[model samples]
Target: MAPISAIALLSFSLLSISISLILSSNIIEDLNLPPPPDFRSTILKNCKENPLIRYCNAVSGDISDVFKSTIVAQHLCNESKNPNCSNSFTKIDLSTRPLIAPLYLSFTFFWKYCPLTILTIDLSNNSLKGSFPSDILFCSQIQSLDLSYNGLIGEIPTDGFTNLTNLTFLNLSYNQFGESNILRLHYFARFNSSSFLRSGLLAKDRKFNVGSIVLQVFLLIFVVGIIGCFGWRCLQRPDLLPFFLQRKHKFTQAVLKAATDGFSEGNLVGRNKRVEIYKGILRDGSEGLIEIHRGKFSFESRRDFVEECRILVQLDHKNLVQVLGWCDNREFRAVAMRWTDGYTVVEWLSRNPQWKHRLKVLMRVVEAMCYLQDQWPQVGCEIRTSSIFLSNDHEPLISKLKVQDKNNPSKNVYKFGVFLLELVSNRSPHEGFETGETGFVEWIKIHYRHHVRKVIDERMKTTVITFVQVKQAIGIGLMCTDVSNNQQPSLHQISKMIDRVYQSSLVSQSATHRHKIQRTPTNALKVNGD
Candidate 1:
């Protein structure tokens, strides 16, 4: 009897050990133990199959799948946290991975948890192909997404990414997307982050081949620099000018008047808050615009015009409304910009029903604003949506809008954020509306406080303008137009906030749409002059 009992105990011990071994092996395989076969291939396969594997591989081998599963399951199982993520979800460090596909996929697969809220994907050295997937929108929780240095092709899908509502950083550089394609992505805050997408392939290739082009540019710059260095160079020695200045095909005002048919109202191209622009042709058949300001003319206004001309001369961005030259005769202070054949951003949005185009427009506007705020800090300007004009090609052009305070850079930045909110909300600036209130900000506050739906535009109610984006925009707008100017974000911080707001808005829209929450159209009146 004692021998039989001992045999049974030995058999039970062996069975228990076998079970433990199998469990350990399974955990190791799930956690991608014993080092990845090849980090790149592992990433690629996991991205194509299960993005969670990439996240799993990011951690140390000792960190078992049970731990990860526990955290993920905790968030998923808990009703309150399932909508978002628990505290443990925020601790995931996805920045270690070099590939974007896995990170992008992981974020998408477990979007409900917001697993990648603060992670950065640096796929800068990968050979990944195909267009950015619509599933990328699911990463609304991610703060930074870097897909630079990859072989991504095709136009970025502007409409599908309404899901990434929390993303603060985005980078898609050194790819095969052409000049036009790159221009299309100029609206997103991510594109303007650094020298990542500085020059397009077309521009770079042209610069490489055209040596004379470079020389000419350098010569022009050298002459300008030399003039700056020597006070008597160009300023004092006006008579000893270069041949280019000497050769002139100047046109008389009478000739310009005739070409424009006596400056007919029908020839008018645009009317800003300050000036009316008319299309005109010179005797040599060169076409341009002649601007005529209707408001009070003063010495300060003249100085403003000259200063604006100087700034315009220095500007070279594609999205900016180009200024060719200016004429300041005794009677008028006019500036001639490149003739834009399209309408304002508002008008363009009104006409185009496609969300893709609208998104492209929004991104372009944001990018242009960021460039202006960053590159030209001296302007100390804030862009008002009323100042943004669109050409016939539907390309957005950010005009020299309001200078909030030339001396106070902080004020300028604050106002700039407000302007961004205007674009996001499809509302006019504080002063753009003809209502009794000073601007949309005051009106929004009043409506918000009163719980009135009239604050929202009627046209946008039935459209794709989700409640989430609207709320997010309102929140951002409030933050930007905060009573305390000191709290306003810098250009970099504002860019990140804008990215986050955009991501959140997308997520909110997705959630609302997915849940089929039918939004009732509020009886709102058109506030701006159509």
Candidate 2:
């Protein structure tokens, strides 16, 4: 019995050992299971290499908060701080966040921080400045990027942009890109060309072959030689040059009387309180308009008038009518202006109903105003549709006497805004409209927000015009005409705004034409004026 009991005890001990071994094996397996991967080290390594991170660290600024917050949100924080991992975000919108830094550094920041999941990054209106942020190409996973309303300059680098296979939307408008040749790049094929508005960049890729370059150099040398010889001849015998080119072409009273056929009633074209305008032909067969001041003046007053005429002639601009010279004789006090063959804006619009043509003319008029504002801020000139002439090719030319008003440039801004409304609505600023509005600007303001179709010209209704672009133009007009807003945009700013609208319309047209653009030497989208 003792032997049997000892055997039973040994069997029981073996059973206990087996159970313990099995449990220990299971515990060992559970302990051996691999832990989740920690991304903290990787993130730190990347941040260390990130130039923007280092820059922020050195400066001790809150700019790095964007990066730090991103890290925490991605569950890439230190284990002691936040144990539980959170779902990561796929977008980082820092638009209008008022970032003031070198633009390149911002690109570097985006490059290192943007993850594979990131789809959109907006860094617009940050007042960023510098060359184009080509470093943004490293963010290959991003599908949308907006860097508009910044002060970026230089040529847009086309390299590696195609690597962003997922990219779908891009906005680089209102920035200062030096060239617009990017429109020809295949990477930007899917994007809207209007994304380049207000860039002040013209689409022109001038590729000169070796042979063509050599030929151009030869022609340049030949032209220089001809000019040099002509200059030498002028120096030797000034009489050889035409009197008109030699100096201000002063015409005598007898010559003016004969040119105007003795100032006959048939020759008179217009008359105002200050002057009488008459068609005339100079001795050199040059046709022009003679403006004879109504009354004779004192010798001092005549001298001042002659000085003013000299300055007016010296004010050279493509949009301005050429001043031939002045007449300060006893019988008449007149000024000669070279005749330009074109009708006034009002007459021209009557013939051409196309919105593009009218917008082109308006652009030139604004440009001329900008030129006047920039080059001759002290010189005053009045602009009206009747006084604004569109040449046979639709180039706008301002025709009027130079008035002395230091405050006229600011006034011109308001006048141009009114002109925009006039050109768009086909209604005179002076004429009362059916909307019970006396002023054209007020009429446009009332209708542009909701009833814009009614505000636009009836002729433009038949044409294929983009309503958004028209609205943009009308909005600019409203901004300019707003008397309550003291911070009115300058003529230069207005010129750019109009140019943006014009370019946007051109893009829409080109897209409709199956993206076929007729390229010219100056610009691909420039109209008749250019």
Candidate 3:
């Protein structure tokens, strides 16, 4: 009876507890994101330095509390639902991934929350309107970072970023990064100019050639036979004169606009849903290609769009279409790439209807891809026929390289296999799937050994190609299309394999030609006389 009474009281307490609780309808409301007043006060108290205080004051009105400012910092920890200090500090794991640490998290708070276990800090693109942090370098455990896309006004830390060998991938784009100290990027190993990108650093240095500026303006006015060019400018206003002179400079809206001739429709050379390509002459009198953003893009905000273009303009590789500079004014936005003559890859392939010629062109494309991959380890985008362009000399050039989330090297290999199939079959990737017979990879697997020859384009069959060469190409393609990255051959390995076949074909053709000459009556008489 006593035990029953005790159990009944406990049950009653549990029932009371359950009845007292009331769940709110908006459990995921905005106010829930920020911490209570005590947490905010604690964060503010910890931010002792002048820079941190200035930043806090600027952002305080935006967030309900300090917790709102720490979204990116939360990702640094494994499960930081509430960033409260618990442990006395220790070293962090350097192998952990770097994140955007664009917050005004103070060193005091850093130790409190990080607690010796946090591997890295991230505060990128947080609109931290202030000077740089005073003492973040005290965190010995921090390996990598991202202080990019902030408005922190100052020279980069004199301490340098390469102090930690384990650190990789530091992006400082779109910030007021330029000061007298920042001469070149490689000086800071972890933060480079060309790779993930360092924009605005070199904008002041691009120094659009002055000599070419005068020549181009002269060419523009005289060649068009417009004597009123000076009068036209004078009538337009005094402001227009300075604009024309400085158009020869970079990182300005007027520069790109003048280059595109006010984005005229008559100069339009290419069109797409997202971008418009226009042919134009740069301030240097050299022809240029302009890619204008016409519609909504992958960017979430205008800032993101500007940041993306800023990064893109910094990349330079022989294989990559040369991105000279960009424009991001209030209304107009564009990216300028080096102009090249001739047709897209489709036209080149259609004109040169030979298997050997096509193979060589494909090899050049592969070489370009390999270079791109080597220069930027993170680059692993799809390689399609449409993305490739052919110069007048038949030089294959990759027109674009868009970095995306799915950066598995195997993805590129798979796309290459599809490209190979297109070249061999002379059919688009979706051409055969209309009847639902099978997908490209599945069809190839089904006809691997038997009736494989039937899939080859009838035009390609005219050439006396070796069975081994054809089989090698087909087998390589099949392997590339495999689901597993481990199973697929690397681009370097594929290049070697292709080169082997190409050399064999060259040797075989030469031998056959020599045999023909030896058999000829005129050659036989000349040889006998010798």
Per-residue accuracy of model 1 over 460-524 as CA lDDT, tens digit each: 54334555455555666666667554676655665676666556556766877756644533333
Q: Model 3 segments beyond 4 Å from truth?
A: 1-251, 295-300, 435-438, 461-464, 484-486, 523-530
Clashes of 3: 9
lDDT of 3 by residue, 44-73 (tens): 433432222322453365433334323222
Taking every candidate in turn, the Cα RMSD to the unseen true structure, in Å, is: 36.2, 33.7, 30.5
Residue pairs in clash, model 2: none
State model 1's lDDT: 0.52
Output the better candidate (2/3) by lDDT. Answer: 2
Candidate 1 lDDT score at position 435 = 55
The positional error of residue 280 in candidate 1, measured at the CA in angstroms, is 2.1
lDDT of 2 by residue, 262-376 (tens): 8999989889888799998876688888988856578888877888887788778888888888878654698899888888988976764577777797788888777767777
Select the stronger candidate by lDDT from 1 and 2: 2
Top lDDT hit? 2
Q: What local lDDT score does residue 495 receive in model 1, on the 0 to 100 scale?
A: 60
State in Å the error of residue 420, model 3.
1.5
